[model samples]
Target: MAQDPRALLAKADKQASSARGGFSLFGGKQDKLEIAADLYTQAANAFRVQKLGREAGQTLEKAAAIQQEINEPDDAANSFVEAYKAYRKDDPSSAARVLEKAIQHYTLRGNFRRAATHQQNLAELLELEIGDIPKAVAAYEIAGDWFQSDNAEALANKVFLKVADLAALEGMYPKAIERYEGVARSSAGNNLMKWSMKDYFLKAGICHLASRDKIAFKKALDSYVELDPSFPSMREFQLLNDMLEADDGGDAEAFADKIFLYDQMSKLDKWKTTMLLRVKSSTTAPKPPLLGCIEEDDDDGLA
Candidate 1:
């Protein structure tokens, strides 16, 4: 027979209360705390089975607190992560909060890989759950740096690309270009990533255009080819060159035609679609101001 969740919760609560209250003749405070933490974890799992995420999360937090009190750092961190998992669906705010606690624990212990993983997770939580773009970018950047520190170049580059994507969305074009260009330059040496070079460079070019800087945008193209000799041969280079001419004349149609051709060959992702649209919008010349009160001769009838 399944144990009643309410009964399990009550039993866990009583055990935790007794552990926190005082020492006992049967055992020391640490022993009592261990038992209480175990019971709390058990109850938390039962609550999870019942889909009581909030209750499970809170109960798991109690276990984590007791684990910390008993100087079980690893257990405490694990409990905190478990609590975050439980709270994610029902209470994402609490989930992010506790997940950060676990991240801090891993960071303090010099666990860069774990820190990087959870930091990336935290960044997604901030990005997707909270809709906080700036904080999410910051967290993602930290995770990328940590991954780099851990010698995980592939993971670091992936996270850095995400930072670039979000930064471009926020209209921070220079920041986005820097990240994209940086990754492109770094990835140039890797044979596996060579094909992706044009993409990164293309994104950086679009971001430069999105910033509406024609001169710098033109210069960036030459710089990209220099960074990787193969870049000029790619279709991306031709597309950028086409857009540059269109931008000079403020010809929206010309710019769009170039994008259309490029899209047919290599489909643009959401980020590219957004950036290209920005570039397309900026290609139109601003309307001349209305001329008011223009002097005119009275029918010019030799008067």
Candidate 2:
């Protein structure tokens, strides 16, 4: 007898329905959950064969949920990831949702590395697909923390930089500066990343200027100089020093003109351009309360 795909799908569905009924009768029994998960998996396969991607994704997600309930978190995470893959071609939002579920299950199962990977994936999806910068930053921060916990320092630092970049774009300068500074300090011993510390310090100083916190900006400049005294000779460093001097000398227009001229002449990259533009805007706008006072917040307490 020839096999009928639709008949198989219907039978799988019936099995799933029976398993759902058994949930009420069996009261969260592991065996019942296993049966349900198996039935849902079968239904998902049938749906896939029938080219019903949405149904396949839904069935797979159901199986994942049952697997989670039955304490099979690894299985649940894999199923959720499969569901995400099934939905990704047609429904990005649904795929992202399932990917988040997979991340959650992996996290709950103490699989920090897998959790961090999924978190990074979700962050990229939020940033590129959804265009949600704040949420993307939050996701990236979580991923960075997980990666750090897993001793993936390089990956963690990369993710932390992403969070800082997004925070700067969102005008969260203090947070951005803190995160950038955090990565710089943490990478102090790594030869490959040490070179980037000066750039991070420069960016953090730019963030301070963007927040109109001259004291913080000066402190950041001092910190950079302490790290690499030659920083004072760099063109960017000189530009920043000139701005601070103009601010001190009460030459607002000169400061503004200097920024404008440098902005035009430097042909800065997108990140630098964005940071400089933000500083320009802040220079004209009324300064908010000081939030970047790194000195007072820094507590190298008594030995």
Candidate 3:
């Protein structure tokens, strides 16, 4: 006599459950794709026992598709996730596949933010990985932008400093300076951050000078002095003195006077003394020299 279909179905279901249970606890370390395939196969077998041909067919199809992904996956991490989710309730394999898909998708993006997230997940998967610092720096910078947009200046500044440190490590002083400036500028508008400005301005000035940005150097120096009178940097001191004396806009007569004063001081103290006395004895206030007159004087001297 033929067995009752319901009893046969119950027996098949029990066997399927046993297979799935063994598969789930068997290995803590297995390929995500392989485990997912096994679970799907078990689910299909159970559905077939109940004569649910449609569900069985669907489960088998999902298994094959997921297996193919492990072989030659593309940019469809999202799709993989969806498939994994749909079958995960009955399968631990599916859950693992979902997490793997998340990593794959993020890694494919190549953007600092995305790569950072993926790299973090990947790091958890392995003990030792190379080039982590560079990735961390890039991620921190990207996170800085996100934090800035969300009005988290303190966090942003922290990340900005990390970027500067990385740039310095790469021997990219100019790039490092730019990153430092971002930190300074973000702090500038707030009174609480005012104390930081003194150091920030001085550092910016030094970087500007090194980069040959005379205009930026001058401006930064001006800010630095305003914040603190005793700012050190013999280079800035000399530059400031020359700039003040050159207020006549590079006039040859003014330059000659500078040279003359130096020469007199070097020759004899009495000569400088006499020159100072004469300068103080002028009967009338001197008029400002016209810029055009300096050019004409230059032309006449050349001719």
For model 2, the stretches where C-alpha displacement exceeds 4 angstroms are: 1-8, 18-53, 69-71, 88-93, 246-267, 284-303
Candidate 2, backbone clash total: 0
Q: Candidate 3 at residue 266, lDDT? A: 39
lDDT of each: 0.84, 0.76, 0.49
Candidate 3 lDDT over 201-232, as tens digits, reads 54454345334456666676665565556554
> Which candidate comes out best when scored by lDDT?
1
Cα lDDT tens digits for candidate 1, 1-303: 655666877887787788778768887777888988888888898888889999999999988998999999999999999998898878889999999999999999999999999999989988988889999999999999999999999999999999999999999889899899989988988999878988888889888888988788878988998988877778999998998888888876666667767766876665666567666666455422210001121122331
- Clashes per model (N, Cα, C within 3 A): 0, 0, 0
Best by TM-score: 1
Rank by lDDT, highest first. 1, 2, 3
**10 residues in a row with least lDDT, candidate 1:** 289-298
Residue-wise lDDT of candidate 2 within 224-294, one digit each (tens)?
77776667777678788877776666555656556556655554456765566555544543432231222
Error of 1 at 277 (Å): 1.1
Candidate 1 at residue 122, lDDT? 88
Candidate number that wins on TM-score, 1 or 2: 1
Candidate 3 global TM-score: 0.36
Q: Write out the backbone clash pairs for model 3.
A: none
